[model samples]
Target: MARIAFILLCHKDPKAIIRQAEQLTAVGDYISIHFDARAPKDAYAMIRDALADNSNVTFARKRIRCGWGEWSLVQATLHAVEAAVEAFPRATHFYMVSGDCMAIKSAQYAHAVLDADDVDYIESFDFFESDWIKTGMKEERLIYRHWFNERNQKTLFYRSWWLQRRLGLERSVPADLQVMIGSQWWCLRRRTIEWILDFTRKRRDVMRFFRTTWIPDETFFQTLVRHLVPEPEIRTRTLTFLMFTDYGMPVTFYNDHYDLLLSQDYLFARKISPEAGQLKERLGRLYASDRTDFKISDEGRKLFQFLTGRGRIGRRFAPRFWETETSLGRERELMIIACKKWHVAKRLVGSIKHHTNLTAIDYLFNEEDTPLPDLGGIQTTLEKRTRHRRALMRMLFDYHETDRLIFCIDTANLDLMQDFFSDRSTTRLLEIACEFTDEYLAGHAKRVGLAGEETSDETLKQLLPTIRYDVVFEADRIRDAGFPNHGKIRERNTPEENAARIAEFLSVPEDTARSIAQTPYLFAD
Candidate 1:
């Protein structure tokens, strides 16, 4: 079981605590909080009431001022860890998040991010150095703290001198690493946390220094893990959906880089003031979500909204979350292409008609008498053949006003090209299609790795870095559809068909099929 150990630093801001708890409850995640001892009892009661339904949350006994350089954060984190260990010491992993952050759907997405295949999601901006070793921190954020405490004579100046002079503790890392500043907000494997706890047992001066300093929270976990562990894997930057800055501090988003921090791809802007309602409204329109009434001031709320629910952004490309109705254009201007299925085809067309954009999706597939599966509510369409695909591509390029056209393909059969072109050739179709259109696609904006693997043909080199998937499955769907689901898709699903299409598409000899198989890019590549 993967248990999330959420720790809320309950400042006097009771409303923030309540809202945070509510958001967590919405996703069935539990939390534990370290409320400031100075807070009113009423506030705890309120927090308790808001979080009551979540069996996973609890209020910790240790109350301390939440600050940087102080030992409180470390202590608080330890306490939360102890509680988590007690609650579920056997958990697969532990994720530590603040109260302000919330979830967006896609548990699968979370799983994938945390999996071992991907490195931890951290952004390191700056770099420091003591030669062979590297840690993240640059000229920026290197001196944002000042401790005037008399007790700090032992900690602040003296400790700084000790580390600087005695330990020779300086290091440099990639500059981009300085930008992301992986926050304490992070997920750690159970073994990693246990390792961290064990590793810190021997570092006495570090703990002593941390006690009287400010922003110790910022450096403690990072420095300790980095120096001791060969590859400490600490994040200097935070990666949560929400971020905070005091009023006087000026925040720069990596220097004017991009026009927007789009939630669609890796980021969404949060913490705007209520005055930025126009932006909120615009975000809603741009993404097509029903989320309205923007809060320019509530960064956490905006973050929560973005992380947990469908905002206009999701609605823009995939609006199924918002409304179920689709539009049918005035002229019933749909060109349906089907092989021979009718039952499934009728049902499919009916389903497509139920909720499409008006003046969108002009073509349809329907000549076949095949039994089309009634796909309840999932959206769908007919497959395109090599010949028809050329025709469609030509039509789109020639008219440039063909409303919207969708090419649908059958599932399962849409695995690889060989399945579709089992007995048919697609070379002519490929050429014609290319002639009619640029390598770029233009029909509609569809919301939409690495390394190694050599190919045989000395001319056929490694692929360049690109996000574009080779459309292997998509192309297979086109090939297997045997023409449209209505008209004649002359391509037979056989070895001969595969040979012909491979020859046609690749402009190779018929005997090249066997050689293509060894190329790795062809199948299982």
Candidate 2:
């Protein structure tokens, strides 16, 4: 019977904010909102009037003019938490989120996740030991006083820092306390929140030190919580889904990214576009629905890995050389099946399936099942689709458990061929040459009245040499019967001996390799 009290820090979008409050209140949870003092008075009034009838909603007593990388953001959050705690004393836990944040899953799912553990969910890592902050200032954020707003007053902010550096001016933190850093978002138990609030009220000197520290919101509670709560009671991970761009701005989710968002295991996601009305509505319905089967799909994980993990700029080389350099996670291993015809792919897939534990996905580049009509135009749609497919291929390589994978691709989907071969570290490829000679291919293209085939053929021919692979199956030699699926696959090898060529390359079990070699496989177009 764990009850959660939500504290939302909102500035604008009164309508969206009202809807968010309504959705949370409808499910028996209490929410407190802190509207920024700088926002229009009418926006704040509208949000208040909309939630006037709901007893579960309340507004903070004071609204602070919050700024990015400033102390006021944490002050606003504190006001919201104070209001929520005072209003709802029985609340077991407190969840802090921004106005644009939405519930990706049901409320019960969150309760279920939290009820199993009495630990606090907040990202707290040693500021000195951990490389939590990705780019820009690091230890300098704490050492030098950051008086100007980093976002609005970029020039003054830098100038102040330079002046401080030139003068050799450095601030001293409390010797007893170790600084910590993490994402500002968190879900903490009431006891933890109460302890943090109490600690802040009593420790004026420590608070004064943090007020001048850069991005205090990310460090304040993170450092204080570690001081108040025991290590065993704390779980250093944020329950919120937060992804940042290379420039360190949080990624804004749009309507077209619905599928990608659904693929994550996070309970809530933030920084949604204000214009994403459709996405907001759909997620609302999903939150209210009694659906229990929430799963993280392979496609979703792959998309996440691509966007946040492997696809990030400069990540590929940094972590390999620098011990302090960090990455999202490991990329998966991949193997590709490039075939001339569908039947040849089918034969190879079946042989591999019979021999190994690997699962072969047939025609992965087929048209996407869901239509993204809102994304606009044919070109835009194609671009999004291509991006998603690339993410999928990358995700597959990161699936570390199953090392071997077979995917079927024909000349029709040559658009994705280059993308699949982009990452060389985790990819093992096999190619199946066309059965027909160049002259025969040209004649066939003419007879079929399909000129596009000639273009695709040339594209494949030119692309194949540039791509790296472990083996290639000659169409001429494989035309005869009794072709072994496993054997020694060298640059110079005859097809006279029935062999398990791919199995040999993959080094599968001997018994499985024998089964693959002995199996009579027929290839059709």
Candidate 3:
């Protein structure tokens, strides 16, 4: 039997972390945990006592006071890796994950996949070539020296960023090292882990340089793996499912995400909370079962249809068609709009109403048979009724100036919209997608409503391409924009928490912010 070593980095939630440990406990397996040094000593003791019975579980002799966006995270991970390898020298594969992550697939299945491939599973992309980081923040993170205190709080020693730029005081990233960044979660072969340990020990300068960089955990391993491993030996896909909210927080998985979780080919899902004990139990039982394969279930397929408006089993529902030619006449600075779904459209419009002064535009694909509710500052227009969604999108493109700001209401038409507007350099596009759990169920209902007896392969091929979206929104940007609902459907931030974020972002009174957030639409005076 091939032995697997799991290195878990845990900060808070001891109960949840211990539960994760229990699930992975098995013969020929080793679990090495590195608890954040900042956590209460009692909490660490509690976890230690809980795992006392498991001979496979061990703790890192060294723990770092881990801080977010700091080099401490990288140090902690390295420590866990070192400890795991030391304890279980015969381990074939090393898997690193957060304490909140749980295995979606059986351990046997995970081992089988690894056994079939000699390659490493890690996601990496060249920093300069990708838009992973925000436009201007890349330089700030890589070049400037950032220091954190014992509390893991960043200190602002230099107020004048412009002064530092003029003086050229910032250090350049190592010229010999090609900077790569990606998700921190990864599973590496034993030989690869050994090589990384050896390389980092010899390269003190590299280690020191990364210590001063922002979020070094994400970059350090990616850069080293890319530099050392042969291209054929590396698999660029991570085996974890992590959805980020506009606010930069990982979306917490709940019972509602069961279908979405099943839909993914990933072996593990992250940031599950203790409150979802039932969900955890269910997943554990499912993972223990031998019959469950790595294929999407029927419910998962229905969800896929609901989300992207594809895979309708029987019905051939056309994109809602409405005929109206209402242009802004003159190009406006910003316009928000949605596709056929009115409920989604209204909510999106409401989220941005108070934050921005731009008016909302509704692009109806279907005829306006029923009257719509009062969406303040939101105007409705008929998208040219056509069999092809691309044709109607082309009409919208023709109507708006290339430089106008357009907020897409949902992600269903994201693919078609991106292709149509790809060449329009000046057009600013911000797409809003609803992430509520019930929304998926609702989508399933809609799919049933539009069901037909047969959907031809040609129809699916045409429909699937148009409905897919290529755009990915960052959680931080979405949170900054005051969008209420994002990330996991079950773990929504409280209204008060959302209001505070809006108040801070827009510099408004808390009460005023709460009022604005209450209505999904801006109230017309």
What is the per-residue lDDT of model 1 for residues 1-525, given as tens digits with 9 covering 90 to 100? Answer: 233455556456576667555544333345667776666888877777877766666667666655544567777876666666565544545556554333432333344445533223333322244221123223323332234332445566455644554665533332322212224555555666677677557655445555544444555555544444344454333445444333323232321111233322222332333334344344333323323222122123332233233222211122232122322323322333232222333333343344333221222332242333333312133444222333333344234454433333332122222222322222122200111111121110111101111211111111111112233333344555554322222222344554454344333466664243223221110
Q: Higher TM-score: candidate 1 or 3?
A: 3
Q: What's the true lDDT of residue 344 in model 3? A: 52
Model 2 per-residue lDDT tens digits across residues 1-525: 678889898788788889998888777888999999999999999998889989899889998898888999988999999999899988898998888899888888777888989999889999988888767799888889999998889999999999999999998888878888888889999999999889888999888889899999989999989988999999998888877665767778888666556556677888789889899998888767766566553233233443353223231122122222322224544566656555656676788786677867666554344222233232144344444554444345344335556677654343344444444435555555544444544443334332222233433343233221211223322232222231223222333232455655555766665565444544323
Instruction: Provide the lowest-lDDT 10-residue window in model 1.
Output: 443-452
Clashes of 1: 87
lDDT of model 2 at position 276: 93
Each candidate's clash count: 87, 12, 15
Best-fitting candidate, scored by lDDT: 2
Query: Distance (Å) between predicted and true CA of 520, model 3?
Result: 43
Write down the lDDT of every candidate, Cα atoms only.
0.39, 0.69, 0.63
Query: After superposing candidate 3, which stretches have Cα over 4 Å from the reference?
Result: 149-163, 297-525
Evaluation by lDDT, superior candidate among 2 and 3 = 2
Return the lDDT, model 2, position 42. Answer: 95
- As for lDDT, the candidate ahead, 1 or 3, is 3
TM-score of each: 0.39, 0.63, 0.60
